[model samples]
Structure formats: C-alpha cells, structure tokens
Target: MTFTGVVPKRRLGPGGPEVPVFALGSWNTWDRMAPPERRALMGRAVEVGAAFFDVAYYNMGPHAEASRTDLLFGETLRELGLARTDYQLCGKLWLWEYPEAGFAEQMRVSLDRIGAGRGGPESFETVVVGDFMGEIDIAQVVRDVQAEIDRGSFASWGVNNWPAEALQLALDTAAAERLTPPSFAQLKYGLVRRSMAEGEFYGGWCADGTLALQASDSFEGGILVGKLAPARKIGADVGGIRERIVAAYPEVERVATDFGATPAQLGLAFCLANPATANVLFGASRVAQLDDNLGAIGVLERVGPDAIRAATAGLWLDRDVRADGVWAP
Candidate 1:
C-alpha cells in the first residue's frame, strides 16, 4: 500500500544515459505464447512503470527449430503502438548458435525482429553478445560488434555472463582497434546468488563504469517465491537447475521467515540494494504475478542498509552447506 512513485533510473554505462530500475524481462513470456498475449503483457508492464524489455535471439530456443521468442517480442512491441524510442530495448545475440558468423547474423535477425532498420532509431538501445559456457573469441566478437555499430545497426554493445578477465580483454581489444567497448554486463545476481556481484565468480564491473543488469535475480522458475515448502522434490517443469537450487538452499525457508516478506520479494530487493546493479529482470506468468512482483519496487524503496545487511547475512547458503556442493564452484 506504500505506492512508491516509481523505481529510480540509472545510466547503462558511464555515458550511455538512464533507464528505469525494475525492467520487465520477457525471457519466458515470449517463447511460450502468441504475439497478442505477448503484446498484452508488454502493455501491462508499461502501464505499471516497467519501460524496459530484456530480450534475446537465443531466447527463441536451443536451435532455430524449437521457438521464436525474439520474433514474437518484436511483433508485440510493434503491435502495442510502442515506438522504438518509447522504451529501452535490450537484446542479446547468442554466438554459440552460429559461432561461424561470430554473432553477426544473430544481431541482424534480432534487429529485424525488433524493427530496427537503416532509417530508424535503433530498435535495441543495447545488444549483448557472448557465451554461456565461458569460452569466447572476445577479439573477433568485438570486431563484429563494431562493424554493426558502423553500419548503424546498434547504438551500443555489451557482453553477457562473461568473466571480468574476458570483459577486460574485450574492452582492451576494442580500444586497440579504435572500436566501441561494452557498456553493460548481464549476469545472475541476487540475494541468494552473490558470486557475480561479490566478484567471486565474475569480477565486479560496477567499479569500472560498466552497468550490471541482474537477470535470474529471481533465481529462475520462482524458487525464491517460497512455493516449494518442507523440502519436497521439486517439480520436473521447474527444470533441473532450479530443482538443484531448492535442494541447495534449504535454509531459504529460515531467511523467508526472518524477512517478514516473501522469498520472491526478498530476492529482488536484494538485487536492487546493490548500487552496481542498474536494473533487475523478472518474468511473470500472468498479470497478477506481474503486479505482485512490481510491489517489490515499493518494498525496495523502504528497505534500509541494515535490512540489506541482515538479509545478506541470513543467506540460505550459510545454513545449507550442500547448496554450493550441488553446483560446480
């Protein structure tokens, strides 16, 4: 009931300028539905103050054969009467799908789906391209991105899930080639997941002027939502990764109790607490879920430093040693 005016905004990079704090991510919503449903969700997101949409070409599916999440995302935006300039668009090019092209074709298809053409303001304000498995040809990828920028395809470029060393390599390579460097790094960061933000997994980018967009900040399939109680086996639909998370963080139950808030809200608020995080991305299966998550924005505004520290101290990992054991360190 607090109804905070709106979430704050911050620049994507040192010079890229500002965007809303709580961007609505469309990772799952797009691939699973038709264009009309996607458009309706986007409209509702805009109405509730989430003006940024995070998307990606690979979000379509493993191979081009499985889905078309990205295409549907672009179609939704166009149908909703939302101009390219009206919202901050962030898309990703998964190079693994076509390492031969080195992410160029991925970017083109992404732009085309988003309606960014030769004469228009680039549909995607920023494009993130990188590997999920931690191996990348940073130099080649950087060069490919610069070519796109030169051709007016992208306003800016970024890296996703890349470690700090690789990020620095990309930046250095771009500087050497007189090309643009990445302005953002999208990684998984949240109250429950601190490896990236704390520089344990990937060195922190915020200190060097690169913005951090925290995804899976809700820990995928709503594990942080407190839906699975009393240590039961997680549903198959929740996916193997999420089941492992629930099995790992058995202590999450205690943390949820201490916060006097839902696990979902606490997880999101944790990500927002970090000044380094430019925005937190979350998805919803329905409008009701979206509204519930948006309420966390107000919860975030009211939370103080002490609360954040307490939440951090109370992480479920501390109580459940098996948590880290489940995943590769």
Candidate 2:
C-alpha cells in the first residue's frame, strides 16, 4: 500500500511535470465531513501517497455556506502538519465563472480561497479553464495564463469540456505567438461515456505530444458501480443516463469478474488503458472509497491493454455522437 510504487509518477504531458497519476477529486467532499474525520482522511491519503489534489472555488458551494472546500482543505493540511511540498495541488476555474472574471482573477480567487502555502506553494501545479462554452478569445486567455506562469503562480494550464475546434485554435495560436499551449485536457470518459475518447479532440491529443488527455467522471457519476439494480428495485428514479448505465452494467460486471474487480475498478482501468489518457480523476467520499479507487492503479497493469479494450468496447456505442458531445453533469 505504499504509493511510492511507480504507479504514482506519471508524465502529465509532453513537457509537463511528472505528477501523480491519480489526484484526489475535491468537489464538495472535503467540507461535508467533520474536522476530525477530515483530518483522518487526509492523513490516510498522504500515507498512501495520494498527496495530489484538485479543487476549485465555485465547486466549494454557495458563498453563504460554512467553510469553503478550499479553506477546509488548507486547514486540514496545516492541522496535520503536512507541508505544501508534501503534495501537489491543482485548482480549476468553474465553467460558469471562468469567462466572467477572466483567467487572472479566476485563478487569484481560487488561490486565495485555498488559503496560503498549503500545497507546496500558495499556487497550483496547473490550473484548468473549467469549460469553454462561450465565444472564447483563446489567444487572450493563453496570454493571461502565461502571465501567471511567468510569475510562478502555476506551472502549466489546460482546458476542460472545451470543443475540439476551440482547443485546436488555442494550440495554433500559441504556436504562432510562441506561447505555451495547454499541456492537458480534462473531460468525461468512462465505459458509459465515450464522447471525449471517440471524438477528434481525443484522437488529436493522442497523435501529438502537445496535450495529454485526462479523464474525469470515469464512472459516469457512480452509475458504473453496479448498485443501480437495488435502487431501481426500490423505485428510485434511475432514468436517462442512469438507465443506460444500468442496462450496460451486466456487461461491465461480467468483465470485472474476469479480473476479480468491482465494476467501478474495471471502469477506471478501462479509462487508464486508453493511450491518450495521461491521468484519471475520480471522487471518493470516504477513506475506504479512496483506497478502493486508488487500487485501480494496480488493476491497470493486471488488466493489460487488450483485455481492457475487449471489456469496454461497444458498451456506449452512441456516446461519441451525443448532442452535447461533452459529458458533464
């Protein structure tokens, strides 16, 4: 259970830093727990070498709430005496707020919220532009991010849920302007969600070293955990994507049994198996869930390339053609 194994170190992108393959997903989970339990979970995560984490301001919930997630994370680190150098932290701009405040302000707010010097620096190893949903001026954003990089605020930057065309334009502009382009992309990818993996965006990243593809929602928001059957039996409203995922569960279960893993683990392995995927991000509400999912790192090599593909292919046949094409819920 020592994460010191080679599993922890992964090249984030072509010339990006060697970050851990799995960074703890800190959405609302951090603030939901009691302070004592929160400290315990952080200790366990560090023990297992899951020192890397990702959090954002807007994702910390309403401004009126208790301590925001960023502040809570920082407090826990200080309480546990974990130095900023002990972990690598990533902060992202929420999809809705990125455009409103622009790059610099968005990043400044996130860092301020996370408090100071809790993750090796008061800054991020990289910060993500949460989503590209507007008439974006890609060149301008890149310059703003480069300014942060120059000031040593963040080492690199990337996009999330951005369209293929927009990503390309940004890259092309960076090349012409001789600025650093995005080093990675964060998007939804899983057994039941294949839009990012099947489309031109993923294909292009796979073909080049300029950007690495990192998967989020690799379980389709827990539908691939294979527990929906009970929920359905109890008349739970498991419709839409949940319905599709439940329908696909049997296939996933069958494959998982072959490898002695749960459907969730198999799903995670399936994502990590993809050539374009440099990293996979997943949620863990408790310490045990964190242990189970981090265990997917081991499952990666045991499952191998061919078995992982055969197990996951054809499950979500229409995933790439979905109307939005970017699966985020």
Task: List lDDT for all candidates, in order.
Answer: 0.61, 0.70
Residue pairs of candidate 2 with colliding backbone atoms: 84-120, 85-120
lDDT of 2 at 295: 66
Q: Give the TM-score of candidate 1.
A: 0.80
Number of the top-ranking candidate, with lDDT as the measure: 2
TM-score of structure candidate 2: 0.86
CA RMSD (A), model 1: 4.9
lDDT string, candidate 1, 1-329, tens digits: 43336556777775454777777665555766666667677777777567787776554324344346666777776677675566777777775544665455766667766666633235467777754444567788788887877776667866665656677788899889887888776665665555555553343456555555545545545666755552432212211245556664556656645766556666777777777777777766566666666666666666764686575664534222222111222
lDDT of 2 by residue, 1-329 (tens): 52345345677776577776777777666866899888877887777666778877654212224437777877787788777677787778554544566667767767776666434246788877756555667777778778888877888877876767777787888889988888888767678767655566666675576678777867655667855543221211212456666788778888888888877678778877877777888766677777777767778777787878876777864453542324333
Candidate 2 local accuracy as lDDT?
Answer: 0.70
Model 2: how far is 214 from its true place, Å?
1.1
